[model samples]
Target: MKQKIRDILAKHGGLPTPVDQLADDADLYAAGLSSFASVQVMLGIEDAFDVEFPDNRKSFQSIDAITKAVSGLVGSTEAAE
Candidate 1:
């Protein structure tokens, strides 16, 4: 799931730094993740995982946060499966 999220970020995050270089808890916005890019990333994640993020859940600040959110939506650890 982490790798999947990283792939999505790499494709759509628009960050100057590589996604792998950023820690799971790193602040993506500080790492150059733009709002527009975040939306793209979110869309990519949703498409990849076939899960929709709830309208009230807006915590995509880092890889760890995203992993948790995806895991919650997926309801298991096999999210990448």
Candidate 2:
């Protein structure tokens, strides 16, 4: 899961460093994520996870927020199974 998130961020975020090296709680905006990049990140995450993000996803403010939301999404999926 973490690897997938990292790959998405790297693929869409255009970060200078590897995505894993980044702190999950780090401010992505401060870390170099542009507004457009955030949208691409969202799309990447949705595709990678095969999860359709609702409008709520737009509220996430940082990598940690995204991580937590995605984790919960996976957890719910697993629980539902």
Candidate 3:
């Protein structure tokens, strides 16, 4: 899942420094992520995961946070199945 996030970011803006070299727990916004780029990243995530972003979950605006949010959606979807 982390790799998928990295791939999504890479596809959009290429290597964002080397902070991506760090763990998924690393704060991406602190590691050179920009606000505008974050929206694009979020869109890519939605596409990759086929998960809809709820307006209430808009609080998840960081890579790590998005990962957790996506994880939650996956769990919920699996439970529904």
Candidate 4:
């Protein structure tokens, strides 16, 4: 899961530093993640994980936040299935 997040960030983070080198708690916005890129990342994550993001902006703050949010959505979706 972390690897997938890293891959998504690597593809869309727009950071000067590589996404794989970033810590999970790193401030992605501070590391140059733009709003548009984050939206793209969110769409990628939703497609990859087969989950829908709720209408919450804070869900994409950092890699850790996104991981937790995705885990929750995946968990609930699996439970429902």
Segments of candidate 1 deviating more than 4 angstroms: 56-58, 77-81
Q: What is the lDDT of candidate 4?
A: 0.83
Residue pairs that clash (backbone atoms under 3 angstroms), model 2: none
Q: What ranking emerges by TM-score with the best candidate at the front?
A: 1, 4, 2, 3
Could you give candidate 1's per-residue lDDT for residues 1-81 as a string of tens digits?
A: 899899999999989999989999999988998888988988998899899987533568889899988898887857655
Cα TM-score per model: 0.90, 0.74, 0.68, 0.87
lDDT of 2 by residue, 1-81 (tens): 656676788899877666777887777777788788878988898887777667663434666687677877767654232
Model 3: residue 79 alpha-carbon error in angstroms: 12
User: RMSD to the native, candidate 4?
Assistant: 3.3
Q: Candidate 4 on 1-81: residue-level lDDT in tens?
A: 878888988887678999878889888888888888888898998888888898776888788898889889888544332
**What TM-score would candidate 3 get against the native?**
0.68
Residue 58 displacement (Å), model 2: 6.3
What lDDT score belongs to each candidate, Candidate 1 first?
0.87, 0.73, 0.64, 0.83
Question: Worst 10-residue stretch by lDDT in candidate 1?
Answer: 53-62
Residue pairs with colliding backbones in model 3 are none
User: In lDDT terms, which candidate is top?
Assistant: 1
Better candidate by lDDT, 1 or 4: 1
Top candidate on TM-score is 1
lDDT for 13 (candidate 3) = 35
